[model samples]
Target: MRRWFMHLGALVLAGGAAAQSPLAEFDPADFGKVVIQPRQSTSGAGGIAFEQAFGNYQNEPVIAYGEGSQAVRLGRPVGRLDMLFEDGSTGFCTAFIVDDTHLLTNYHCIPGLPRDGVQPQVKAAQFVAGYIRPGHGEGVDRYTVAPNAVEADRALDYAVLEVFGDPSQTYGRLELAGVDPEDGEFLWIIGHPQGQSQHISREGCAASSPAVSGEGKLMHTCDTLGGNSGSPVLRLSDKRVVALHHAGDSRTGYNMAIPMARILAVSKFLKGAEGLPAAAPAPLPEVPAGACDALWAEAKGQGCAGYGAYLASCGTHAFAGLARNLQASDCGTAAPAVIHGALTVKPSGGDFPTLAEAVQRAPYGARVSVWPGVYSGPVYVTKDIEITGAGPRDQIVIDGVMHWSRGRGAVRGLTLRQGVAVDGGSLTLEDNVITSPATGIALRGGDAVVRANLVQQTGEAGVSISSNGAVRVEANRITRSAHAGIEIRDGAAPEVFDNEISDGAQSGVYLHSGGGGVLRGNEIHHNAFHAISAKGAVKPVVRGNRLHSNGYDAVRLREGAGGTWEDNDLSGNRAGGFRVEPDAGNVLLRGNRE
Candidate 1:
């Protein structure tokens, strides 16, 4: 006999300080209307009589399923989520499966969402498998849920669980909708409403709206009660889950659900999920262009302050992406972005009238959105701020250095004509293209991470580091440099990995002045000098590199430099493989393939 399985998570009213209270409000009446219900039940009897109170009415049909019923196939995925908390109070909600082993429910049904996607609450709870009617003539088949299989997001009021076995192979799994159901589409909600056995609200349930006050949410007329908190809102046309019912308004009989689109965006547990439906059309919000020229120099900042308001004005639709990212970081409460967290800047006309003003006016750690156009001035980054291009990386060009100071921040998707120079502080640069006549990145500072970038035609080195902080240079391509592709000195420890260095006028990399770190997974070729040159007290750990067709020696460890080189492809060099000077001490070079 096939059994419909459900692996549920835990739920509780979490404390406020650690997890920010959700700005989005949900009426608790919709979560579970029945109170103090038993954790276990076998008979399909109503836990208690539906009381006649407070002028309540029901236009929806609570249809019970039997053999040859219309809802038998549709109700298979809908199973009971029996949760027993540490306080010894047992609560049961509804959950459904999206895959062979994964189930979706409400975050309030499982309070503590693991940042690491491991569900520890599953072990502390039980699941009443196949608890619905038509299949419940025998006895309740209880399944013990394993630990670390639940993932929850309290803000969205949703939780996903991984079952121990392949249940999708038996009862089958429901699909998730990327778009909402068209108007008048029939909807079905199956759950143990009012703590009763699972029943289907086959009629008087459909998607309606004036969103229950947030982005990517649907207002549905699903007759739900307490235990229905995690029930799936299914679109009858295709039978895909459109949303997860969370709360309802008792005064209006309107219920709200978290849209599946938002769930697909925010849930880390669904990363790289295949066999899912296609994504619906999601357009980026439009941003206006600007001039950061003489007209705005007099004003400290013009129109720039209004950009934040404009971005915020796009409503919940523009905020879905931000909400997804925040939920992944376990911060669902901070949804519906506050403009106070970000700032807007323009090139020469729109906001601030210049890139310089955006830098000067933006608060520390604030995200600055710079519109497209050639901003012909150096941006002095004095504070820890993140500056992003409103358009493509090539569309937003800064003809001067994005000079860094004692600030720590990130710079992404910007084209720096003169390149970047960070003198101090912790800085991370990613996906940036630097076309400089001098140096692409002159990092005299500490704690820098330069990754997935392109550096071209440097008058000096492609990258220069002279600090003591832990720096990481990963997945970067340095080409056509007038000097070395990379230089590290002054006792700096920089880990350079998975970089492509070629066509440089000098060595591919240089380490001097006691500098030391790791250089691995790099493609070093066609340089004018040695592929790598280490001197002084520098002793780096080098491994897993391809050094080929260099104009000079593959590696030169001279003047007291010692190195551990292993697992490298050393071939096609014009000169010798490596040179270890008499005073450079014995270097370890092993596992190299000629």
Candidate 2:
């Protein structure tokens, strides 16, 4: 008795045209009808496989009998359930065996059963399992798990019941299917489909989709109704119970089952001592090439330990385990081996051979340990490498310059005397001291980030940004330079911020050649030229600065300089606070104290 609807043309109904096609008699009274379709083979298989398949899933069989119903058979009878309410009325529930001692059903199957949360509870409850056709009255047997120990995932609408009693009361255990069945596989459900222990059983083939009402790992068909909310949907191929029958589809002839895998994942039955099945083990991923060599290189007897720790101490290395593993490998005087993976390395030899060599040997996503020493070789890095000192006192010094042409790079927590230049890579230099060079750090292409570093005693500009490289220079101390302490040229957007520039031969900060930069939060004083000079510069934001004590004007904007000058404290300078000539447009000034 499945629900099927069809709409024909008005002509057939009015008998105005063509012959009348005989259709099934329509009845509004039989709104809830059950339909059983013939089984068909569906061959599609193998998407997400499972660990184990279900075995024989029947414990104690039950029988169903009613006025409108024919003879029905239940695979495993979830016997009488005891439903205790807050009003003191108790009713028996339908209980099905998942294993020897575990009972499976909907969480709402037994209302007012307080096993957890902040609720009042009693220690006593009744369970009834096995039932048979009495030939006259209700058949009865003992097939119940007691105490209903735990509940979980109430949002999933499922629950597990733990029966605590003698084992002789039950016959056998019910098995759960490991994976989803074929599309058209035969499915069966046995439960109290109308609050009657008449245990109705209906056989139907799996449908393409849910029957329109039920959802999430459910099947749509015309086979079930109320009181069957916690029944089992079993696959006959291996007698496996796949999903817990939760609800029926209202739109079409269908019912829904919660997959066994999800139940097994969150269930804690096997954790108890009541002879339940254990969970399947997890699968492992494939190992990479030279995995053993890489592992051995990170083992003890290596000389590279404190390098990663030092980087972490300076906020240079984001990942900490890489440093510990590099210290464990034995670099064998050739060079310090790179530490990749999750282990710790303790290098037994001296510091890394050279910064460049250390970078070349370390893994792609790892840090190289550079102990405190004067490293006088050129470091051309191509990957994201972190080079750090051994300790504050044991500093890692680079006596020579560094050159990077491609890829991205980062240099942190190390002092450099020679110069550093990046041509194509995105580079970042942080928390270091650069001295003696004409330019402390220079970038020509890609992007550059120079932050929290000291650039002092340079014959030329302390830091220079050129060659179209978008540069961000912030929170730095630049002093004692022959020319401008900081210079932006070659058509780049240079952000100069929060810096102290003093005692320079030329301007404290000089902007030229169409430089698009922001000059803010700077202390510019004691310079030969203007404290801050913007000549032929474009789009410069000059504000929030202490500009004074210079040989020329406190701030100078001339020669078509497109910039802003305001909110500045220009005090005790030789020339006027600001000297803005003609041809300077898009300039704004407000709230100044000179």
Candidate 3:
């Protein structure tokens, strides 16, 4: 049954009371922001553009299943799923149980999420049978996506995955149609829209265009939103799936879906060749010094492709001595640790009200504990001290720029806004949510530990450290950054691991111009370009990351960059798996799990 929690204007819990609520139950009429990667308008001239609303675009949103009591009447084929990934990243989308364990969703929804370098990274799939306001408390049932059970087509945009157990026993399965829906047929689109409850859109929505998208896709007028990516657009008469909802026009007139026939065909083909391995990792070949010298000289002129035949010529461990010879500067000098156990500047007892004020008042050897509230920043701390929050990270928010000027400072349990710049300090940032301006954590000339932080939507990088990249970025969830997730550039070399970085406009982790580092066990996927982009005379040890579902190469090297690349899961990328520009120096590649 659909559980109605409370109204938006007057939300009253059993004991607690909130004047306003964020739940969709109170305001279900408006859908949230569409989360798909925005595409260029097909609405312009000579584009596959669509414009003008096809039907009444301004209708009151109808609550699906009427608060869950009508679940018996509505078909049980469609439902909502919340995908949980390693590194504590989460996403929601729509899906339908197709077989005992098999399920259908858009490829974008589950792209490269199943594996973390041959290991299962997607931890669970929480299914909300009657996905209403989760705050009302009960209706979520979670199932794990089975390891190596993902099959997808990036171009066509459809995926078939197997759940850990049989969802068919509870939700039942949706039947597939081999036939196409006729244009103007009544299209009943049912799925969770905007991460709200399950919704059904039928007001003036119909199958309008046939094959308007890549082969056999149907364009319709079904109202959908971000979380509705994998919605099943069913024909009203029988409730069988006609198309799988994928993309929508931002102009509010049209949405696109892959036909059910195409999805079924792809599923059949994938059933046989699932978990296909990547090609054998090619190592640097054995060559005479003169030959290697000649190739390098030619590559400097023509490019790396000039010696393409010698994949990694110059012999294994060719650059090992060179990599070891480089020294970390005096910037690696040790700093004093922050003194703990002193309480100062809190909401109640301390002299100051804000975090910045507290840090300023506190001596070099004291600790500051802030209360649960939005603390304004430039919370610049120059003293070697510890700054903590009252409770969980979500409750204590620092709403401005945070900077650590002095070395050996610790910050915990705070959601920082704007961004943070730490230089000449050994700072530790943990359990904080940080959005960005330019870079989320700009660690210039600092040795820091950034652990378990949620960094998102940054301009330059999620974590951008300078020449002295003496930092450890681990277990952090970074997404939708304009540049690299962890940009170790200009001679910085940091240890980056266990981070889930996705949808980055540039490489997941970029190593540029004398930067050298180790990238291991990081789930780097769905980025616009390479998972790891190495440039200049840098040699990074890139290993054991799930580098897939990317637009370009899994790893890209240019100019004089080379590295040890091995044991990564590379598949389903738009371009070839890995590449090295002809001018790139010798790259030692071997034993990668493709």
Candidate 4:
């Protein structure tokens, strides 16, 4: 999540200190000096949900064996199987194998939807597993299940169906991944939408956060429609089904899936179902040996590099020991290759000893811990490495020096200053404070996660990612900048969540050139021009945010690009509650107020 602080000129708000001049409408062209009272509603979005029911069906090959009668049970043991009722009419829904005898679907898809908090009909359905058209499509298979014993969560808008049957024999079981995938991992959704295709699957990524409280999970991207209810969402990494699709806020094009962890928790609450035992924790794969040896070797090679003479130690034994202990503990195993060595600056070497040296010494997929102190120098890395503090509170300050250049790298828990450049690479800079820099962080690569940092007093944009994989920016404070607080270039899908961006020169959050992303659960206030600017950004979702006191439009959409603005309160922006430029596309503006 690359973000910046745009200058919104200061102004006075209702009940705030009286301005030197009388109150008047705000002018966005000169917003940098404005101040307004807090607005209502959280400005944020939701992401995908991971469900445990379809653990194996999500990621790996599945093989199950059972008869239609044994595969599922709905409304007593005997009734018409593979049929359901909806909205007082007989509407059909399909159920596939979540487990041998377990099914899943939308709570509303059940025969009896909760009407006025009471069941109007007996909530029951049937299951039909291994429905294959022999000879016509020998290899293609389909399964059906009706809701029999159903448990639903209206807030999450999903339900779990338990069928009666020996699933191992009736159908192919799937391999479920137990871990959440890294960003950029390929993901797929399988189900019927609009009653068009059977076993239809939608592909996306484990891309794009919330505050610490699951705002990110509520704001994810997926192409789903009304009929996608009860579909299983699988990750390509481990084939583990993680989420169950449910309700979505169409305005932001952000879909919500119930995470598997929650389903398991809820399932436990529904224990005592016949033939079902407590859900077992899924197992993760083992890490190979000598995975991080490259880092140690690289560090030694750098120590020998001719850099006016510097000494640093690189080894793996300590790291290996830690890995073994971690795997034995509750946190699970550590990737042996993910360990990184520490590099300390020689005394009087200035701030950051030499970021160039650290990069040269660290190997791909390794972590490099930096010892704290002030060092005036620029740094650059070309490999995948985690650069973090030796220990929290141990500061490595880079004053008046920018770490320019790039090639898939990460910087963590360090202070940076002017001259920092992030040209490319799988880049991530977190837990750092940046001040007075040409640009706080600039990215041209994909697959980045930037979080938990302070970026202020910069001469240029605070954070920018023009291209690459999904970018997620969360939990940061950006104030008083020369340029936009956060600039997301068009053609990149970024999720910006939970940041306090105030008092900047231009727009607080600017999306240009088709900035297709979601802005949810944040405070966008007191900016010079527009609080949120969607210039050529298509279908951006702006929700649950507090937007107040901007010079121009509180939220502006231009160039035929549209966004869904919902559940947000707009006030004192000196313009309309929401403004759409001429020729803008279908930008849904709902659930918002002035």
Residue-level lDDT tens digits of model 2 in 1-594: 221111110001122223322221112222111211111211112111110011222222244343212122224335434443343322223456655456767664533223224242323444544344433223344423454446645545576777655322333345665565556666666654333443544333354443222334656342543345566766544345667765433333344567666676677662212121222122223334355334434432343443432322321233333443343234222122333331111122332456766665554445554444567767777655555543231144787888766544467767788777778656778878887556767777767888888888887888877757667888988888888988877677788889888889999887788876778899988988889887785667777999889888887777777676779898888987877888665678887778
lDDT of 1 at 309: 37
| TM-score of every candidate relative to the true structure | 0.45, 0.42, 0.45, 0.42
Model 2 misplacement above 4 A: 1-348, 467-470, 583-586
Query: Which lDDT tens digits does candidate 1 get at residues 1-594?
Result: 221111221122222322111111112222222222443332111111111011343423233445334465566667776665443344567777677668887765665344335433432544555555432324444445543446767677677776666655445566677666555556888876645566777567777755334556677766655567678888764456877876654444466777777787887765322223322223335433332222223222333332333334432333334332333245323222333334545532244656787778664446766644567879898655677754346556799887887555788878899989888766889988898988899988756899999998899999998877768999999999998999988988889999999999999999999888899999999999989988888889999999989998898888889978999988889887887878895688899876
Q: In model 1, where do residues sit more than 4 Å from their true spots? A: 1-339
Q: Candidate 2 — what's its lDDT? A: 0.55
lDDT of 2 at 590: 84
Number of clashes in every candidate structure?
Answer: 24, 36, 12, 114
The TM-score between candidate 2 and the true structure equals 0.42
Error of 4 at 84 (Å): 76
- Model 3 Cα lDDT, one tens digit per residue, 427-475: 8898778887789988887578989989998987998877374688899
Worst 10 residues of 1 by lDDT: 44-53
Query: What would the per-residue lDDT of candidate 4 be over residues 373-436, giving only the tens digit for each residue?
Result: 4556566555545666532222456665544343345677677766345554456767778776
Q: Which candidate gets the maximum lDDT versus the true structure?
A: 1
Candidate 2, residue 140: lDDT: 45
**Regarding lDDT, does 1 or 3 come out ahead?**
1
